[model samples]
Target: MIKTNTIKSVGLKVPALTFGASGIGNLFHKLSNADAIGIAEGAIEMGWHAFDVAPHYGSSLAEIRLGLALRTLDRDEFVLSTKVGRLLMPRQESGLQNGEEFYDENPFNRVYDYSYDGIMRSYEDSIRRLGTRRIDILYVHDIGKYAHGDIPQEREYFKTLCNSGFKALEELKKSGHIKAYGIGANETEIMMEAMDYTDMDVVLLANRYNMLEPNRDEFFAKCEKRNVSVAAAAVFASGVLVKKNISEGHYEYGKVPKKVFARVVEISKVCDRHDVPIGAAAIQFPLRNKNVVSVVCGVTSIEQVRKNYEWAQWDIPECLWKELAEIGIK
Candidate 1:
C-alpha cells in the first residue's frame, strides 16, 4: 500500500500517489470503455484510491468512465477530486473541438465559467457525472495566464474568480459539498497571486514543482507558511523524466526543448550511476517537501499503472539526491 498523509488544512488523508484521470479521458489517444475502467479498477487494486479528474478532460468523459469504475466500490474507501471553471455544454456538431488536447471525447463543448453560479453549477454537474455525493477536493481549473495567455481576458477571469467564484468555493466547504477548495493550475505565478486574494486550503500545482523543474522553492515555501497543502501533478514533466532516451520524451506537453533534454540527460546519467531508475527518482522527488501531500500521475494502461507503482516504491540512495543537487536538479 502507498503511504498516506493528512492534508492538514482540510484534515483529509490522501495517498502519497494520486491517480490522475487524464489518461482515461483519452488524452492524446482514445481508449475503449473496458480499458478505461480497467485502469481505474487496477489502480484501486494497487491501493491508489485517490483520484483527480476535471471536466476539461474529455469534456466529462473521464468523469463518466471513472464513475462507472467506482460505482461498485464503497464510496468511503476512496478520496475524489474534480475541477471547475470549465462547464460542459452540449455540442451541436462534434468530431473534434478545436484546440482540445483530448481525443475521442464526449460530444460536449467546454465553456470557461468562473462566476458564483458557474462554480456551483459545475460542482453539481460534476457530482452527477462522477456519481458521487460530494467531492473531497474541488479545484478551480486553469484560472491563470497559462491557459488564457497574457491578455485582458485573463485578468477578467481572475477577477471573476476573486470577486464571485471564490465565494462559491468557500460556501461549498462550509456546506459540506466539498471538504476543501483550491486552484488547479500548471503555472505558479497566478497561484501566488491567488494566495493574496483568498485562503485556499490546497493547490493542485502541475509541472512546476517536479523533478525536471524544481526551482519553485519560493512558491512551495509560501504554501507551507500559509498552511496550504499541495497536490503535485505532472511529476514526470509529461513523460520526459521517465523515457529511456531524452529525445523520446515530451516537456510541458510539447516537443522537448534542447536545453530541457540536455538537463534530463545529465540527471539521467547521475541516476544511472546510482543504479536508480530516473523515473523512480522523479516519482519520489516532490514529496521531499513537507507541504506536498500527493504526487499525481496519469497512466493509460494497466502496465503503466503497475510501472508507476513500482517506481513510486523504488528505493534510491541518499547520495543520488546529492549528486542531482550538484547538477542543479534539487
Candidate 2:
C-alpha cells in the first residue's frame, strides 16, 4: 500500500496525489457516469483528498458527478478544484446538453472565453454544477489555446483576469468559497506568464514537463524560487510512456504513434534495469522536484485507481535518475 503524503505550503495542505477527472469523462475515449463515480469513490478510499476537473471535460458533467459522489461524504474531507475561461452558453437549438460552441453541436466544444463577463459566467455555472458554495481552487484553464487567430489576445485576457480575477476570487476566498488562484494549462510558457499576472499559489503543468519532453527547467526554477507549488501532471505523456505498441502492454490512448512507442520502449528498459515498472515510474516521476506538490493522473475504474496507487510503493533509484539524466532533460 502507498502511504499518502500530505504537503503543507503557504498555509495550504495539499495531497500528494490528485485524480484528474478527465478519465471519468473519458477524455481519452468515452465513459459512463457510473464508472466515473466509482473511480471517484475509489480514489477517496485510497486517500486522494484533491480532485481536479474542468468544464471543458465532458461538458462539466465530471464535476457534477464528482459533486454527486462528494455529497455522499462530508464536504470538508477533500479539496475540489475546477477551471474557468470556458463559458457555458444557453443550450442552443439542440437543448441544454446539446448547446453549440463556435457553431459545433457538442455543448462541450469550448472556445476561449476569458473576457471578464465570460470568466465570471463560467465560474457561476461551475458553482451551480458543482453544487458547492465555493471551490477549493479555481484555475484559468489553457489561456494559451488560440481561438481568435491571436494567441496574444487570449493571454491579454488572462492577464486582465489575473489582475481583477484575484480581486473577485478574494471575495470568494474571504467568504471561504475558494482556497487558491492559479493557472492550469497543457502548455508551459503560459504558466511562466501567469506569475506576473496573479499572486499564484499553485500552477498545474499538465504533461508539459514529463520524461519524454522535459523542457521546463526555467519554469520549475522560478516556481522553486517563488515558493510556488507545482502540480505536475500528464506524467504518462498521453500514454506514450506505456508503449501499447509492445504486444504485451495494456494501455491504449487513442492511437499510439511509432516513434512514441520506440521512445517509451527505451524508457521501459531503463525502468526495468532500476527495478521499477514503467507505470510505477510514470506515477513517481513528477515528484522529482520538491516543489511538485502533487501528481495528477486519470483512472477509469477502481481497479485502475488501485494500480496507480500500487506504484507509490517503489521509487526510482539514483542510478535510474542518473541514466535518465544522461538522456539530456535538464
Candidate 3:
C-alpha cells in the first residue's frame, strides 16, 4: 500500500496519491454527474482522501459534484483543498451553453480577481459550493505569467496579491476559515517570487518537476528551508510521460515539442532496458524529491485511479535513476 504523508500546517494526513478534480470536471469530454461522482467515490474507496479542486474547473461544477459525492462520507476522514482567484459568476444568459474554457459544464463564467474582497468572496463561494465547513488547504490560483501570459500585467496583479490577497489568506487562516494557504501555479518562479511577500504552507506546482524536466532543485531547496510542502500536480507532464507513444503525448496541455519528444524517447529506451514501466517511474519520480509531499493526479475513471495507485507502489531499481542521469536528462 502507498503510505500517506502529513501536511504540517493543517495537521492533516494525505495520501501520497492525491486525486485532482479536473478530469471529473470534464476537462476534455462530456461527463455526467453520476459518472463523475462515481469516480470520486471510487477514489475514496481506493484510499485517496486528499482531493484538490478549483472553481475554474468546470466553473464550480467540480466542487458541487464533489460535495454531493462526499456528503455521506465523514468529512474528518478526508483532506480537501481548493483554489481561489477565478470567481465563478452565474451566466448572464439562462439557456444551456457550451463552456469556453472547461468543456461541457454548468452555466457560469470565471472572473479573474485576486484582491482581498475577491479572495474572501471566492473562498465563501467555494465553501458553499463544496458544502464543507472549511477547506484544509487554499491556493491562490494562477496569478503568474504562465496563466495570465502578459508578464508585465501579471507582475502588477501579483503585487496586488502581495498587498491584499496574501493578507486575506492570512486573515482566513487566523480565523480558522482555512487551515493553510499557498499558491497553485504551473511554474517554479512564481513560488520563489511569492516567498518574497509571505511564507507559504503549501504549493501546488504542475508539470514542472517530473523526470523529463527536473531542473527545480534550487526551488525545492528553498521550499525545504521554508518548511513549505509541495503537491506535485500533472507529474506525467499532462500525458507525455505515461502515454504509450510520443504521437499520443502532450506536454503542458499542448502537443509535445520535437526536442522534448526526442528526450522522452531516450528515457523510454533506458526504462525499457531496466524493465520498468515509464509511467511508474514517471509518477514515482517526484516523491523522491524531499520537498514533494504528494502527487495530485487527475482521473476521469476508476481505472486511472487504480493505475495511479499501482504505479505509486511499483518497485523501482536504484540503477534506473543512475541510468537516467547518465543520459542528458540533467
lDDT against the true structure, each candidate: 0.89, 0.70, 0.85
- What does candidate 1's lDDT look like per residue over 216-246, in tens digits? 8799888887889999999999988877675
Q: In candidate 2, residue 140 scores what lDDT?
A: 79
lDDT of 3 by residue, 1-330 (tens): 678887765665777888899988887667899999999998888877788999988888899988888886798888899999987777888653446436778888778889999999999999999999889899998888899997688888898899999999999999988888899998889898898789889899988888777888789888888878999999888888777666784687767888888778788889999999888888888888867789989888899989988888999999998888787444
| TM-score for predicted model 2 compared with the true structure | 0.85
Score every model by TM-score. 0.97, 0.85, 0.94
Ordered from best to worst TM-score, the candidate numbers read: 1, 3, 2
- Candidate structures ordered by lDDT, highest first: 1, 3, 2
| Number of colliding residue pairs in model 1 | 0
| Candidate topping TM-score | 1
- After aligning candidate 3 to the native by TM-score, how far in Å is the CA of 285 from where it should be? 0.5
Report the Cα lDDT for candidate 3.
0.85
| Candidate 3 or 1, higher TM-score | 1
Give per-residue CA lDDT, model 2, range 145-169, as digits (tens). Answer: 5323356776667666766665665
Top-scoring candidate (lDDT): 1
The worst-scoring run of ten residues by lDDT in candidate 1 lies at: 93-102
